[model samples]
Each structure stands twice: as C-alpha cells, then as structure tokens.
Target: MNFKEKIFSILSNKEFDNLTWNIFHDQIKNNITYKNYLQFLEINPFEIKNISEIPFLPISFFKTHRIFSSRTTDDYDIIFTSSGTTGIKSKHYVKNLNIYIDSIRNSFEFFYGPIEKFKFLGFIPTNRKDSSLIYMIKYLIQQTHKNGSHFIPYHNYKDIFSNQNDKNIFIFGLSFFLLDFIEKNNHLQQNMQKNESKNKVIIMETGGMKGKRKEIIREELHDILKKFFCVKEIHSEYGMTELLSQAYAKKNGKFQCPPWMKVYIRDPEDPFIHINNNKIGGIDIIDLSNYLSCPFISTEDLGKKINDNEFEVLGRMDFSDIRGCNLMTPHFLEC
Candidate 1:
C-alpha cells in the first residue's frame, strides 16, 4: 500500500495494535535515529513484539539534528519551529508539505467533522509568522470557502459579531488572545444569550499563555470562556511542532488522540519504562502520520493516561535536563 492508503487503513481498522506494530517496525528499519536508539538500548527491533518496547527519541533532538526518517534533503518544503521565550527552538523540517496538510485535515475531520461545514475564525494575538497553527488555520479557512471563514486581526469584534449568522462557527485562538478578546467584548455575553442563533458556536483554544499573560488553570480558563461565549463546553487543540498529528479536547481538558496516534505515559525517572494507566508520568507519543519524520517522541510534558484512547496533559516537567545543548557551539551561543 502507498503511504496515504496505509495510514487511512490503519486509522479505519479496529486492530490498531497490529497495524501500529507493523508501522513501528518499518520506522525502526528506515529511521536512523530509531535504529541508533534501538542499538543504544541493546534491544533488537525484531524482538520488540509489544509497542511499549519501542524507545522514543527525546523531543530535543529536533533542535540539534535534522530529523527525517525517510529521505535526506538539501531542501525542505517548509520548516516549523517551536514557540518559546528563551532556549533553542525545536525545528521540524517538513520534506513534503502535503503530508503535514493531509495529517492536519484528516485529524480534524476525524475528531470534529467536515471542514466545509464550519465557519473558521482564527485569532493570533501576536504578529509572529511561520506558525504551524497559523498555517493550519489558513488552510482550514481556504478549504471551508464560507464567507465568514477568515483570520481576524486586532480583535475586530465589530466585524466578527456583525458576520455571526446561522452557520456553524468555530473560533480558533491562542489562550491569551481568547482571554483578551472575551474581556474586551464582555458586552456581547448578553447579546449572545438573546440571539438564540441556530449556529453551534465552538471556541477552540490552542493552549499557551506565550508569556503574554498570567498563566491560569484550565478550569478557570474554561469557566471564563463558558461565561463569555455562553457555550456549555470549550474545546482545545493539543499539538507541537515536532509531530504531524494532533489530539483534540472537546471538554473537561480530556484529550482524545486520533486513530493514527497513540499516547503512552512513561516513568520520568526511567524514560524507557512505560507506566500504567492513570499514573502521572512523562508523555510519549506515537504519531503514525509522522512517518516522514520520527514517529516516536518523548515529550517533556507531564501527563497521565485517561484510558487506552484518551489522555490529559498536566503540565511540563520543571527540572528536566536540556538535551540538545551539547550540540551548541561557542560561536553559535555568542550569536
């Protein structure tokens, strides 16, 4: 099967474990990092029958190395980097933009519905360009072809509120931007209550304060959103630049992975050891959609498995050792 067909079949099939193992073996054989990691662990890939036996590459590797499982490249179609106040940004070199686009489109439709059905409104508080989130939003808007689907700049409430109609509306915003928008448009709360429009409005927050505002707990954030939007639940998008796949949270901060993705909680003390369900540990992800890049990644986020298909992101580890620092040279640091 071709790449797209294989991924689609894996997602649609009920026997995910077998499908995942097959993909894992393929990755191990093709990916240099995976091969090296397996060698370092002194574990033969052929001996790894269970998915838990697979070792995940530390997420920091993206910062220091060019991470691609398949092709070596002198050029990349697009490069996505992590957002941060300080420290080296993790760069994801996308060889084929189509793969990333396919992953984003399929994952969203998997969780929510067709892209054309919703009027997407994206709000990014800052002016930073080349954001994967921004790119995804722009793609969604273009695909939707709805009159109201577009990116709103400077919290243009007048334009947004004026355009609100019976169509299903989805507002994608960064946490701080959403907070700012809601605070500035507090007067709309009562108006929203009275309008009684047939449109099912969903406020999906792409989590991150981005050092722009004081960090608040998810509960408080959701409460404010619920109060302002008059919606029963708030949705969230959980993703990073390192991986192609995304997990979504409809409500209550519980995120469910897409069929092609899986989350495993690993013991922070021993990164190789996978922990049981409901136990707080480091988050390790297997994103089969990331076949071009490394499929397995060990993230710095602290989280626990809610079930086989669901997980909750608690927070990041406070004192985790920085991984890619060794590769930084004095001249690079001076710059």
Candidate 2:
C-alpha cells in the first residue's frame, strides 16, 4: 500500500511506529530539503532506527523554504497559509487535499463522536485568504450540510446561539473575537441564563488574542468564557498551518491528541533533550498525518506532557514573533 493508505490505517502503537519509520526514510530520500537538512546535521539517515533519534526540522524552515516531499514542484494540490498578523507567514504545500480532509474529519470524530451529531457555528475573521483553520471549519460545516450550520458575522452573536436545534451546537471563533463578542453582549449572560438552549452550546476558541486585548492566562480566559457562554467547560483547538492534524482541549486547557499524533516536551535551551513528565519545555510534534509535508516538526511553542495521552500548551517561547491563533503566554508559565 502507498504511504497515504498505510498512514490512515494506523491502529496500534507498533503500527504507528513502523509507518513513521517508513515515512521518515521516504522523506529523507524523496524530500530534497529534508535530505539536505539531515546531511547538514552530519546525521546518517540509515543509522536512525528509533523515533527519538530522528531530527525534527525547525518549524521556522517552513517560512524560509517550501517544505514538501515530492519529486517535482508542481505536485501540490493546495497551500495552507498561517494567520499571522505580522512578519512572514508559513505556507504548507499539501500534495493531497484528501489527506487533510480525512485528518480533520477523523480527528474531530475521534474527540467528539460524529460530525453529523453537531451543528457547527463559527465566526472566523478573514485576515488571510488562504487560512488552514478557515478551510478546516468550512469543510466540517459543509460536510454536515445542514441548514443552520454556517459562519456568522460578528454583529450576529444572538443569531449564532439562537439555533434551537436538538443537535449539539459547536461554536467556533478566534480567541479575540470570542472575547469581543462576550464583552459587547454582556446581556448574553443574563439572557442565556434564562434560556434552556444554552445547555446545548459548546464554545471552542481557536487561539489568537494577540494585539486585540490584554493577554490573559488560560484559566482566567476560560473562567470568563464559561460565565458568559453558560457552559460547563470551554473547548480549545490546538493546530497550526504547518500541521495536518489537530489536538483538542475539552476542559481546563489540557489537550488530547488523536492516535496518529503525539506531543513531546523538549528542553528549551537544548533542543535535542526530550523532557519527561510535567517539566515545561519546547514542544516537538510527531504528526504522522503530516506525511506529505514534514511529519516531525520542532515548534516554538512551550508545553508540558501531562501523561501518555494528554499535554498542556503553556505558551510560546521568548524571542519568537507573536503570531495569530496562539494563546497568551501567562506570566506564571514563563517561569
């Protein structure tokens, strides 16, 4: 079977390991940029056997170079760009759009049951035209193909939550936009308190509070949102332009990855050292679904692994450019 077939077929941990090794080898051979990156590091691809030994290309490389694993330049189907407000944006040249579609659908279903069970309502500010987050949201909403499942303007916050459907309402918005909505609609708190439909609402923030308001900690942010939205817990999506798969945080800012994706905490000063347990460090991602592009990426975000199945995104590392769709760096997590 092809890499695409084998990747999605991953079930067991052993199977994931085998496929990752296969993809790593394939990328070193076929992906010119990755091959040169390993060569410059004086690392022999043949000597690498275990997953930890493999070198993760820095995510910044995506901005400076075209990170793709194809023999020719014309092989990509679409490019997914970052939603950064300043500086150069990272672009991911996707070879197979189907892989991304499947990744979004499968990842969502893995976390929240079936897509058909929820009516997706979102307010995605169009800062960038080729936004990966927008594409994911649009694709999922379209898949439901229901009458009430669609994007709403910022002024229509009441209309967004007014859907009285039986299906669970999955409301999506950028971190800043969600905050803006609630602040302006303080009446929503009083109104929603009386409405029985508030129980069906699920508010999911897509990060990015930069430049919009004072950056606050996740705990405080969730507290405000919970009070305003009248929900038990606030949901958050952990994703980027460079990655095909996403991890979801259902409650208390703790994120859980799907079977095909994994997160590792690496030492902030020393990139090679992978920290264990709750020690805060830079995040190294092994997104097996990012096969076409670079699967192994060393992101600038700081985080800690809670356990084998869970992790927490603390914030971004210092000196990194402030980008959109990124959470606030709490003063405490900075320590």
Candidate 3:
C-alpha cells in the first residue's frame, strides 16, 4: 500500500516503527539534505536498525536547507510557511496536497470525531498568506459544509454564534487573537450562554502570541481562556510549518499524537541521548506522514512525556525563535 494508506491504518507500535524505518531508509537514499546530515554525523544509514537509532534532522534546517525526500524537486503542490514573527521563517514544501489534507483530516478525526459534525470558525489574522494553519482551518471549514463556518477577521467579532442548529462549534484561533477576542468582548459569556445549553463550544488555541502580548505559561493562558470562553478545557493544536502531521491536546495541556506520529524527549545538552518519560527535555518528533520531506525532526520545543502515547509541550528551547503553538517558558533552563 502507498504511504497515505499505510499511515492511517497504523494499529500497533511495531507497525509504526516498521514504517518509520522504511521512510528513514527512503529519506537517506533520496533526500540530499538528510543524507548529508547523517553523513556529517559520521553515521551509516545501513547500520541503523531501530527507530531510536535514526538521527532526526534539526527543524531549523528547514529554514536553512531545502529538505525534500523526493526524486524530483519541481512537483511541489504547496509550500507552507511559518509565521516568522520573530525571525526567519521555515518553509515546508509539500509534494502532494492530498497527503497533507489526509494527515490533517485523519489526525483531527482521531482526536475529535469527524470534521463534518462540527462547525469550524477560524479567527486567524490574515497578516501572512502562506500559513499552514490557515490552510488547514479553511479546509476543515469547507469539509463541515455548515452555513456559519467561516474565518473571522481580527477585532471584528461578528454574531456568528447566534443560530447554531445543534452542531458543535470549534473556534480555531492564534493565542494572541483568541486572547484579544476575550479581552475585548466582555459579553462573550452571555453570548456563549445562549448556546451553552444546546451546542458544545470548543475554543482551540494554535499557540504563539506573535509579539502581540507578553508570553505566559500555558497553564495560566489556558486558565484565562477556560474562564473567559466558559469552557472547561482549552484545546490546543501542536504543529509547525515544518511538519505535515499535528498533535492535539483535548484537556489539561497534555498532547496526544496520532498513530503515525510519535514524540520523544531528548536531553538539551546532549541531543543524541533521549531522556526517560516525564523528564523535561527538548522535543523530538517522528512523523511518518512527513515522507516527502524529512520524517524525523528534532524541534526546538521543550516537553515531557506523560506516557508512551502522550506528551506535554512546556515551552521553547532557550534563545530559539519564538514561533506558534508551543509556549515560551524560562522553566526549561532549570531542567
């Protein structure tokens, strides 16, 4: 079966590991950037048997290098760019749009049922055009086929929540914009109360304050969001421009990845040694769906694994470019 089919059908850890190995082999053979990275480390791809032994390409390389694990370079369907609000932006060249859409849909469905059952309302500011989050939200809104599902501009909080006919409402917005929405609209509780008895409202933050506000801890931010939105838990989407797959946190700021995606924590001082579970360290991800680019990516975020299947993103690495989704916390330095 093709990777698109195999990725969604992953049922066991063994199957996922086996597929990751295959993807890694392909990446080493076809992707020049990854091959060079591995070569620079003085590691032979053939000697690596386990998934843990495979060296993940640093996510910053996406900004500095053209990472494509494909035979040709001209078949890019879409290029997803990062917010870059802090510094240089990272760009992910998606060879097939269908793969990305499939990953988005499957991952979303894995966490929160099907997209058709919810009305998606995006509150992302249109400061940049090539945003992967905006594209994903737009696609989800289209899939819902709901009447009031649309993108709302910044500072223009329209009365879109008035006539929701029993469908769950999902408001996907950036961290700053969502905060701005609640701070400016004091009557949000009253507006939300009208539908509270009938429809479920889910406010999901896609991280990043974008220099619009001071950076705060995720727990504090979630607490503010939960109280203002009248929701018990504030949902979060953990993703970046460099990744095709996304992890979702339903509650308490604990994120769970889909079957094809796995998260690992590595020691910050020593990038090669992966720390034990519940240890706060740098975040490393293995996204099998990132087959076109690089599947394994060592990110700049600091996180701790709750268990084998779940993790928590505490903040970014020290001095790293502040980006979307993951919050920034100085507590990581104490680790």
Best by lDDT: 3
lDDT of 1 by residue, 77-196 (tens): 898888877999988888788888998898999888888788888877435555788788888989886556877664556545565454688889898988888778787778777643
Q: How do the predictions measure up, each by TM-score?
A: 0.90, 0.91, 0.92
Summed over model 3, clashes come to: 0
Instruction: List clashing residue pairs in candidate 3.
Output: none
Please give the range of 10 consecutive residues that has the lowest summed lDDT in model 1.
326-335
Clashes of each: 0, 0, 0
Stretches of candidate 3 off by over 4 Å are 319-335
Question: What tens-digit string does per-residue lDDT give for candidate 3 at 1-335?
Answer: 25778888999998998898878878888998887777667789899766777787778777766678876777898888887777778888888889999999999999899788888899887656688888899889887755568888747768756775745889898998888877788776787766566778898999879788999888888898877777888899999999988999989888999999999887765777788998988899999889989889989888999899789998878844324213212122210
Off by over 4 Å in 1: 11-15, 320-335
Backbone clash tally (model 2) = 0
- Overall local distance difference test of candidate 1: 0.78
Candidate lDDT scores, in order, read: 0.78, 0.80, 0.82
Model 3 residue 118 lDDT score? 83
Task: State model 2's lDDT.
Answer: 0.80
